[model samples]
Target chain A: MSHEPRDNPAQHREQREPEELHTPIGWPLLVVFLGIIAWGAFYYFHDLLSATGATSEAGDRRSVVVVDPTAKADGAAVYAGNCAACHQATGMGLPGAFPPLAGSEWVLASKDIPIQILLHGMSGPITVKGSLYAGVMPAFAQLEDAEIAAVLTHVRKSWGNAAAEITADDIASGRKAFADKSTPWSEAELKDKVGAP
Target chain B: MSLSIAFLLAMTFLISVGGLALLVWALANDQFGMGQQAAETIFAPGEVGEVEDPATPSAARAVMQNARKAAHQASDSEELFERTIADQSSRMPVLFWLSSSMVWLLLGSVFGVIASIKLHLPDWLVQEAVLTFGRIRPAHLNVVAYGWASMAGVGVGLWLIPRLFKTALVGGHYAIAGGLIWNAGLIFGTAAILAGLSDGLEWLEFPWQTDIALVIGGALAAVPLILTLIKKRVGHLYVSAWYLIAALVWFPMLFVTANIPNLFVGVDQAMLNWWFAHNVLGLWMTPLGLAAAYYFIPKIIGKPIRSYGLSLIGFWALALFYSQVGLHHLIGGPVPTWAVTISIVHSVMMVIPVIAVAVNHHMTMLGSFRLMLYSPTLRFVVLGAMMYTFASVQGSMEALRSVNTITHFTHYTVAHAHMGLYGFLSFVLFGSVYFILPRLLDWEWPHAWAISLHFWLVFVGWGIYFWPLTLGGWLQGLAMLDPARSFMESVS
Candidate 1:
């Protein structure tokens, strides 16, 4: 029996049973586990605390319930949702990439000029506050007249711009005035239609 | 829906509390006192410190021979019985499961490549409704996930259990029948998906009727494994056996629990979808891969695992952490803040298991790294093990709110999914198959170089496949985030 080889398949003891080295779970793992737990508990409670303070129980009903078209649009909310991405929430847009809406001559020119610019998007080079900006601003034609007017009113009131508030009636008239315009307007094209301020 | 979230949250909380209680009990009772003695459980009488693999030197083999012969003085009849059990268990069922799984793998890969190609060239296969990207994509996913990956897992798992128990498979016929039914169900389900009769959920594209087949088939397959465990000749179960047995139970439970008809609706349905989808990877595929790695890595290299305690930590932490991670898939979705937050934390907590497993495997393989050069199984399994660490840690990071916000809808997610499922799980399965097939069939792999070629091709191919998509997807996410970039620009 002592002479028999351990490699034969027919033998029940052909292979050794798998063993384990006597390594201990050292302090590093303990530290990591405790650290993660502490962080998780902190994060969880922090989220709950901040969420409670910041949000009402109503809690983002924008998606859950249907909006009433007759309800007055919140100008600031509209601006935050649509325009704030490009034109900063501060209304001071990205330098070179986007033009600032804060105290812009184009925005404060005539109410008609800003309304037309928004209804039909701008392309090619356009100057805002003496800086030349070349980019595309997508048309907000899909927006309701009230939403368009509300966002425009928001920009006008914000960022030290003392322009008068634009009404939904102004947006409606602007849409009708440029109903045939399918393509975006260039800076030259906009100047040709409504003279520069 | 809130009820569902509350239920899941409570369940996670209960598991954490229960785990903590168990830890306290262990500490109080000194359960972890005998770390060295616990590590010795895997060794039989004279097997301790014995190198029993083919790579062992002739002098070492002689020493092993003397030790084993002295320790295990079995009679001639006992040896015959052992041989008989080994030969009998490696019969019809394993072959059927493995061969069919290979066939499905080939088919699934073809479908996947076609779907991928169509993403760039939409008009390429648009003529056939079945070949359109929408139909083909889900078809590919379902086929690979259920038909190929699951079947391979069952085959290898079934084969390993009998060996671990030192007994013949208790109900081999049931596994065969189950394999047939499972294949039939997969075929019907895939055809139905191509014919536009899908359920329209990501992993649940197979209709309810087909899901019934899957549940029944899975139950049938599990019978033999459970019975084998019950009828075992071995006194103590190994860590690998634990993983395999747990998987057999976990998969069936997950499949049945998630597949109950009309069980969830609207937001709850989305939650359930991700829960099941993620757990399929976590509980089902992951256990099988880890079990294979735990067994083969030590067996091939002629070494014990690094630490028995770490293995226990890895297993328990995985159970407690992984189950909660499903909700991380809904991180930025319409789910409750607390629920997603818990999931994110759990996802991060997964680092515990990943690190534990990593240390054990790495330390075990420390001196035997050169074995990968000669053993195809070692190469594939080791790479898979390493990727498990990589994929898991990456997944943990990806679950963070800050990271998920960018990568959620992008191809980055797709790349990450493949790293885990394909690079980790599939590679492990491939290695297991390489090792198991030769033993089961009583024949060596005809071409070792061919196996090496296959490895390199996949290794290189996966690198080519993964990096671009990950980088491109990250850039895509960035572009989508930037207000200056157009929608079409991001698409391009």
Candidate 2:
């Protein structure tokens, strides 16, 4: 044992354990932790309990609604689920691939032109806001007439664009007009038939 | 789902409150007031008795007595305790756990290498489902985090805690059993993961059945440590003991809470997943690494810490702030904005403890820069401490919305993780192993060249692994943000 201690210098060095200082300052630190928890709880419950009707900055871009209150809410929901991915929540669509619904001449032109586009999709080169976009817009003819009306109404009134609300009657008329159309409409065909705004 | 969320929140609340209450009790009882006496306890002769020598001449005996008295007045108890602790137990269980940790480290490294190769060569292992990137990646993560880092930490803790508490290990057999069971669990869990029977959660990828084995194994292994703590000869709980014990307690609670079958669903499951994942690092691995650094740095340097107060702040702040910061992983995700916001706030608050730890360590090593040259342990530990500070500050910044916007889905996050787990935690653990092995095994390292080689290889290897990923990943993120750049352009 003596030889062992002699061989290992590390073992012979004295351990210097620090004196455990008495510090009363830890209470305030604990308070900070508690405060954070309280704030988190408050925030969580506030988010959960509060209704979605609060007019947020996000909602400001899509405020126009002259339809039934239920229809407006349904339209917002429909837009969020179906159209927001490519066209974006603000309807300020992707730069090259998707065309913007916000401030689009086609959306604000007339109910028939937009309704026609919704019933029979559009394709090929098209100009939106002075940019040439060659993209395919899929048809939403499978949507209920009321749903089509609500969503179109949402797009038309949103993003500072004011237009008359498209109704179920208008969607029904557009569907009837494009009943025989199976494939997407070409830009030339859309312009020839529906006419540019 | 809501009930589980409430349960998790309640658990966090209870832990915070319980910890605070312990502090309050300690304060009110003046447990900290007898610092000098408590510091001297390790040196004081135990009730077991000491041998007396009466054969010496009067003059020689007088000189010897005076020398003994002078030595008692100084801080020589550390040396006495060291010898006592080393000689008390067989130290076989610690060796067993450490050996198991090394095995896992090698296994994990193999998995990690395979996983990394598959990243660039996706078709290399496409033939077998077991070898697919998805399975191998999770296995690598689990093995390294739970299998390597954790086992190594526990092994080190088993050896270190008793020495700190100045008590003989009470449950050596139980600890060995625990180590075996833990390894068994890891083996089965890794196999199950490879078989694609995963639970589909990050860090909790082990199915519930496998988790049971781990939970049991961990509990068994913790028995001796807890017992040692209970029968501690010292009055004051050292900072290292606080970290080690808290980690032991925190881990089982975290493991059980996060892995309960079908306890949460949808986004709530996601929330709990991140909560568990982040805390496993913050609470478990981080504490172990920090605890090692706290112990070895001072022990090797043979000095008291600069500020015990800062150490307490560091420990408590880590406990409180680290628990909630996990939700920052889900920023810009489907989870609620409020949850993400709170997580961000908590993540930023991590700076308090990081700085506390940094200042304490920095001030302790203020004039001892030359120790890094001669002491292999100091070199590794000091590097680890520096990396810890760097990794944590980077983590805080990364949690911010501005930085996360670019770095969120990039390899930058991966680089950051490696910096933490491998660079910081693993490095510290390595230092601990180097320092402890000699004492436990009663042998010096066979070759100093090997250690030097290891230090350079790992240090350089980490630099190579980390910098490219960070810079390249940042560039990739920038490219991804631009609509004009093709996805392939960013990837390639």
Candidate 3:
């Protein structure tokens, strides 16, 4: 610690000059910071304008899109990057090793089961885009609430399937039910639950 | 526009030009002469005191005075430095504390709110010139980055550099003038934006009229610093000074280069515009803020940096690498390949400095974990430095061709920006403000609850805000790469 500079213990001791408070405040810094605040207000309004620029896409279209939240690119990316690697991009997964997404009725036919299947992925024989594919689809329960919702949405939207959106809130509800990712889903486990559609 | 309105607008532009002239004049004079000596001579008046004492006119006296003047100048150069420790006992505690932290905390909080809400509800409010996300986002950023952080950073820098170097502020006049211009510009610029007249670029959103006044204010602010350095007693030239000086140089360049509107005639605006804006975050603000953390943390705790050479490499590399960091952003854009290639290369090079600075900061805090138990400054700064490391790694990753494939222009970049600026730079500055407030004000902060409240609101708000963006960005990035996807399909 030879290069170490020693602190004077006396320096740490307190003093009481309630009067030296007028140590010339900096004008330039104030201007810079304040300038930024004003600058931000400009964008607040500008962003408002940019938002309005696309009036058609704001409200109604969003609802239709949200209905298939997996349609969310972020959500879908998670699905494709992680899930699709095995689910065989088509969802008509490999007969035994992976499941096919193409025309799988399970994805289109149900809402509640998909959430369950997504949260605690199916390992035993399960139905996907259609035919009974017996493969272990890893549980994504450990994924972030948003990720879980997104993957479920992607599967629902892709491969000629149709279903309601899987929102973040729905995933949160599933999280409350199962916090860990170890459990695998059976068809019976998802046989009765109903998603908000 | 009416003649009167036109006149007012013209006057604003005039003010900008006028300030730039003053800045250039000061800079030019500095090149030819040791102009900074004027402030030091004012305070010490060493030889001038005795030389002028014999008021009688005599050549012999004048020659004798010259010899003494040279000696005094030589001696003054070898300073017995003091860390400009404020008689921390000063009582104007409220004004000092409030000006530095309270003002910015409030400003930052407001912008934080808007930033979060704007994400989900881009069209939640009126779609006027004054209320667009584009205008408001930059305005919010400038306020947080400039309005709040810069004020507080300079306030702390004003006090701390002197202390660390064992010196005091030399010119109150310059400091005071700078303060006025800075505040007036901020108020006017913020108001103008609220009124819906913004230039509509990131950080450079402040229209030319107000920006000019702020630059004038900045030069005035810098005077005391130039004066203090000349008066500095230490030869050690601590690492913090390096960080600060880099910031001072970088900010003006960012503003001058970015604000040169004629350069952005029509089509090539975005390419040039983003270059300036992104670099400001990379070079100007972050360096100053991080430099403060490096100086204060160990200065207070009583330790040497884990590696001095590493600190040097980090600082110099940051200066070099940061200048070309924005190009990775436009990797897939129509900007020339060379531009994108250099930026991406520097962005990757950015990793070296980031790690070096982080190691210097975080490792120094390793044994001083006990300080975090009692010192709020250490806690905030440590957190900020940690964030600096986090965000930087993410930046390099995003710069990579492969990784950018998944993160570019998505919520991921948004999150990274926040993590770097707000998470690292802003967080550290907040701590610096809190620490300096007590030292300058003489009394301890009256409202710890308020302080805690401020920190929590910012922390939680930021987490809630940035996390979603990263997740969403990743998905968006994936969708963009899918060739089958159209614009509507990608966002959808």
Which candidate achieves the best TM-score against the true structure? 1
Report per-candidate DockQ: 0.17, 0.08, 0.02
Q: Give a tens-digit lDDT track for model 2, residues A1-197.
A: 22223344334333444333333344555566456556645654454345234443332243474676554437888899889999999899999889899999888996888898888888899888888899888999889888889999999988998999888888888878768888887878988987877
**DockQ winner, 1 or 3:** 1
lDDT of each: 0.79, 0.78, 0.61
TM per candidate, chain B:
0.90, 0.88, 0.77
- First chain of model 3: TM-score? 0.52
lDDT tens digits, residue span B1-492, model 2:
244554555456456546645755675566666454555464444311111111122343244334334333443444555455643462788899889999999999999999999889989988989999999999999999888999999988887877777667878888888888888889989999999999989999998898888998899888888787788877677889889999999999999999998899999999999999999999999999998889877665544577666687689878877889999899778776657765776787677678778877887877666656666677888899999999999999998878998998899999999999989998998888886776666555666768778888999999999999999989989988887789988889
For model 3 the TM-score comes to 0.58
Best by lDDT: 1
Candidate 3 lDDT, tens digit per residue, B1-492? 233433443343334334433433443344423233432332333311212111112343344344334433321211211321332211132234238445755876676667567766767764576666665666677777667767766665666556545555566467666777887888788777777677876667788889998788777767766787888765455677777777777788778777876777543676777778778777777777777787666544544456444465467667655776676677667554445655665576566567667766666667566655345556678878888889888887787778986887677887888898788887887776666554443345666557667677877977986798888889898887776678666565
Give the runs in model 2 whose Cα sits over 4 Å from its true position.
Answer: A1-10, A13-197, B1-31, B34-84, B87-90
Query: Arrange candidates by TM-score, highest first: which order?
Result: 1, 2, 3
List of clashing residue pairs for candidate 2 = A15-B78
Rank list by lDDT: 1, 2, 3
**Global lDDT for candidate 3?**
0.61
